[model samples]
Target: MSPTDTDALADDLLAYIDASPTPYHAVRETARRLEQAGYRALDERESWTLKPGERVYVTRGDTSIAAFHLGTAPVDRAGFRLVGSHTDSPNLRLKPNAQVAKNGYQQLGVEIYGGVLLHTWTDRDLSLAGRVVLLEGGKPRGHLVDFRKPLLRVPNLAIHLNRGVNTEGLKLNPQEQMVPVLGLESAGAVDLRAMLVKELSKGGVKAEAADILGYDLCLYDLQPSTRSGAHEEFLHAPRLDNLASCHSSLTALLTGPASREATSGVILFDHEEVGSRSAQGAASPFLRTLLERLTLVLSDGKPDAFHRAMAQSFLVSADMAHAVHPNYASLHEPKHQPQMGAGPVIKSNVNQSYATDGESWAYFAALCREAGVTPQHFVTRTDLGCGSTIGPITAGQLGIRTVDVGNPMLSMHSIREMACASDVAAMVAVLRRLFA
Candidate 1:
């Protein structure tokens, strides 16, 4: 794969990721593509069935999923190749009993989830997306609800009123400033459950407050992702941090062969932005269980072979890398300013924030050569603390030689993020070659 090809696919994948506002939506999009490519879905209650030349998938608690293909020959678990990534990012999550009416205004009460740039969320055109629970004929039902259009806005206080805004740098009070405007008072008292009931009613379901199972809802910018700048060389979008990785792995699976002599897989996890400790997160049994089940099924009940394959597996933890900001260039290390379109990054930190080491880096560099990608290096400033990911956690849990990699991104965790347009397609092409 050439750099040009990777850049093109990156843009395509970024659009897909930007469209998925929640983990459920992310998994749904992935399932759609897999089904299109002739991959069969599995029921959790079904018995194990092993067959050669069949594409397989496993789901855990709705949000996390692992997909792989069986090769013509028996796969060596000891030499398996895996791409690991997460589905979650930093944002605001809706709280239960979320409706709050104040001074004739209707607002949705929300809690900050993960490490988010709170100030970036204010004054943006926002829309809600997540799963909704309902009662259909007295039974619980799940529905994917996406208010695609801009339905709310958290307006910032005027500069004239906030005399300290410029000097103090706009300190945001999450409770007061983050309230999203729903409708006018004449629109009547805004009951959140009632609004949900009304929306679910259209889907043939009767919903009540009690019928509301917890949701993973988020507010996102309503703007569509697109190429920008005079040369049309930059990509502007939201949630590019880890979504870029999710899209790349999914695209690689679809475009690459069904199976190879070695085991190849893609795992997308949830709650990575919040320390990855949930039931479906990197810290749980999700990945381990999926691999064990796959090995058991692929080995035709041969425990010895399955164990061998498990011992030989390798994983690539794909997350977004930080690019050197032109305005804040002083914050980055001089020698390690990872440039956009320079190629994919192998992120490293001595404190284990990233899991890449000498051995893992070398192996990935070899794979990049085979895939025709020029692998780049990323390191943070000496005086600052670095952000962590599922990379080190998964490495500690699975004992796999894991390499941390991603596309360089600017304005990370902002309501609207930016990256080079060419890098998107470049990543896809490289992933295709690696998966092959």
Candidate 2:
């Protein structure tokens, strides 16, 4: 890809990361894009009558989404070409009893959601965004909220108070040190539920404190994603670990040519950062249920057609890969060090952390070669522990041939992460070829 194409794609990726503060928001943004591209939404509770060349999508719990375009050939003859990615990232989530006041200061109690770099969260401007459930006519309803302003902050203790912070490293307790200061209590007690009701009213959603049945809110940095570096080759953003892959895969699905030989699709699952056990996660039956329904509809209830389609299907599990850190070069495998600005990476693990095998690896590498791009390889060092993706779990569930691949990045679980701008375009190009 040329510099102009790379810069354009990087700009789009940054916008996506900035817009998506939570998994619910990510799915909503993706659904917006898919709908703009003429894909219609299908309700799972209702009957679906699908036809060839039809573009359709289905959502589960408003967090996970699967979109597909039927091909000209029968599904049993031409199986699915699928790209998978996750929507969740490591962050702080608000607890049920979140309101707490100490020494005339009000704070929100939070629970760490996943493996987070706790220190990075200190001394940052934070805001709240997620879904809140409200009661309406004796039923619970959900509404998306985005407090776009800096409503809270987690300040770091001064250096003078902790003199050995630099050399000895700073340690924080999630229960005590991680609570964010919302404001000061002036008069009497501050009712947190009433405060939420006021905020919702400002956003044009009328509700009372009694109407709030539940919520799933999280705190996020207020900083906007941007392109940095001398040549603008570096991109810095939040939630890039999996959202970058999600954006690339969605773009590829929308831009790729409608194939006559395969049914092309993309799935963005939720809850991967926290072990993917939810109804919308990869460990659940969401993907398999959709695939079976599609097969049954396409084959007119033919016997064994779903299994036949699975036999010929292929899945490319896309997640962010660890790039060789400049400050810690010795941490990576010597020969298989993936570099920023390099092309996509093909990841493998012998212990089944990733699903890449010889056959699938060769298949993906050939796709990259056909796209005129060089593919990199990644394997964790023998002495170190390896992080996992949804690749292996999804493959085991469906018995489909799967390959793990992604763009190289740094700061895997930090609040703000970095990546090469050029790699975004490269991965999108390879995925476009795969979908075509």
RMSD of candidates 1 onward, in order: 2.3, 1.7
Off by over 4 Å in 2: 1-4, 187-189
Best-fitting candidate, scored by TM-score: 2
lDDT of 1 by residue, 1-436 (tens): 3334645575677668766888888888888878887888876678868677778777776678888876565554335678889887778778776777787777888888777888888888898888886665677667877777787888888989999888889888887777788777768877766666676677676667677765657787888887888888788888887788898887777778655766678899999988889899999988877777777766655657655765677788989999889899999988888899787888999999999999989988888887667888889888999888888998898777888989898988887788887777666666767677
Model 2's lDDT to the true fold? 0.91
TM-score of each: 0.93, 0.97
TM-score of candidate 2 versus the correct structure, residues matched by position: 0.97
Error at 282, model 2, angstroms = 0.1
Ten contiguous residues minimizing lDDT sum, candidate 1: 1-10
Error of 1 at 126 (Å): 1.1
Clashing residue pairs in all predictions, respectively, total: 12, 0
CA lDDT of each prediction against the hidden true structure: 0.79, 0.91
